[model samples]
Target: MPQDRTLLYAGRGFEVAHVRLHAPQGPVWSDLYTVASPRVVFPIGRTRLDVRSGDDTWLTDALTAIRFGDATAYRLRPETAAVRHSLVVSGHASVGPTHGASTTGVSVCLMTPQALYRMHAARRQLPDTDGTQAATLVASLVAYLAGAPHQAPWHGAVARARQLLLSEGSGPGTRVLSLDELAEAVSRSPFHLARRFRQQTGLSLHQYRQHLRLASAMERLADGERDLAGLAHDLGYCSQSHLGAVFRQAVGVTLGDARRVLGPAGTGASASARI
Candidate 1:
């Protein structure tokens, strides 16, 4: 009489949770899976969303839907900066192109089912009174995905600085622009720009630059190329050991260890190997 829940994705730093509905006469499982990205967002027609995780409960009426965003858009921060939030889609829902919808508003990079379930339980006790429970849940999710208190404003020089970080390759990778050049490109005073970059992105210009460098390293490691030393030098590390120290301190693991774990799984084991 009820739909079946499922685990769509699981990784080192992310996980996607899902539930499929086959209303006796509704869409068939084949029709549902045939959609573009088997891993995508689904919209609710007239059904309700009833989520129950542990001690939490969240509900939503028709009109609530799910979608995806680019995980490559993630910003690097201190490991201690992670913020956890819960997502629960109520009622008939489906998948789309890619990514999953946490709240109708936020795009959560599925962390862990255990974590999601826990948050679901917490959400139940905090339903919205404005009749837009779905919106509330999603808003909370978006905030969490945004690095919480570190969510960069949509418009600001610092935000622009962060945009620069996530866009294309930089520093150790292919970005040829230097700090002063980018500051000039953004038309902000270097001193002021550095301060704002710190306030907004939660790191200095130099530090965020390292973030990009680290991201690039992770990508290389995931390739399973086995050129750790070459990858390090190419990514701007003074040497293999230099990259190893920074990578371990920032990513929580050694370059070799991450490569072995990811083994081409694309699980962000690369992220953990980055400097």
Candidate 2:
């Protein structure tokens, strides 16, 4: 595997780096690395890698954020040839689990659509200075993650259902299956799937799908997509107006404002959106 990174910002007590990994045609293992300072990572782009910290393993992707504290040792083993992008924030001492401050292991959490959008926009802008601004952003993000509730491990049908939903619903052009379809695909009754899914992830099926659609919209808008009507249709919305309404309600900014800031060669415009 070949990996590269670029330092985007450096501050008094925190710094941000954009890291990328490129794997060969087959599975590969990276050299062991140890964390020297507390850090949080926001995964970007398409990602599929098993993070091994001691005997525990965690799967990380676009919808997940990972935190590692000082002295943590870990390695990456990619199951296939792929490219991955991530934002690594180091020097922040409070990036550990929300419940307590044991810095020896890893903490992974599901990122809400708004949180993911903020991270994606930040990566797109790639500010090279302004430590004060960077620190503020990092602190806001850490606090948001800390407040978000965590779920216990999910398995069996619930896990399979989640996998199907994320994989199929994340695309800009893919329409998510209906509840009946999803339940059948996951080998469970609709009622059973609905209850178990909520119990496992603390989100209804509809809510999770909405998150996927919104995340897709943010990613494309950040990439400079301008066709609101087409984008809405592709994402299974009734129309452009429908998408606009939901986007504003969830992100606290209009689509036009978001596009202006997250467009190609963004002007570094900041939004009042939730951090």
Candidate 1's residue-wise lDDT over 1-275, tens digit each? 24465543333223344444544433222121111232323321223333322222222212112233222111211112222111333221232212333322223222221222223222222221221332333344433433423121245676465556544343355655677877887889888888877664456667666645665565455345588888887877778899888777776666676556433542322222231
On the 0 to 100 scale, the lDDT of residue 168 in model 2 is 76
The top-ranked prediction according to lDDT is 2
| Predicted structure 1, TM vs. truth | 0.45
Model 1: worst 10 consecutive residues (lDDT sum): 72-81
- Candidate 2, residues 48-136, lDDT tens digits: the string is 56677776666555666778867889888775677777788887666766574234467777787777767766665556234455457
Model 2 segments beyond 4 Å from truth? 26-33, 75-80, 98-104, 124-131, 151-154, 169-175, 269-275
- Would you list the clashing residue pairs of candidate 2? none
Residue 45 lDDT, candidate 1, scale 0-100:
22
Q: What is the C-alpha RMSD of each candidate to the true structure, in Å?
A: 15.9, 3.2
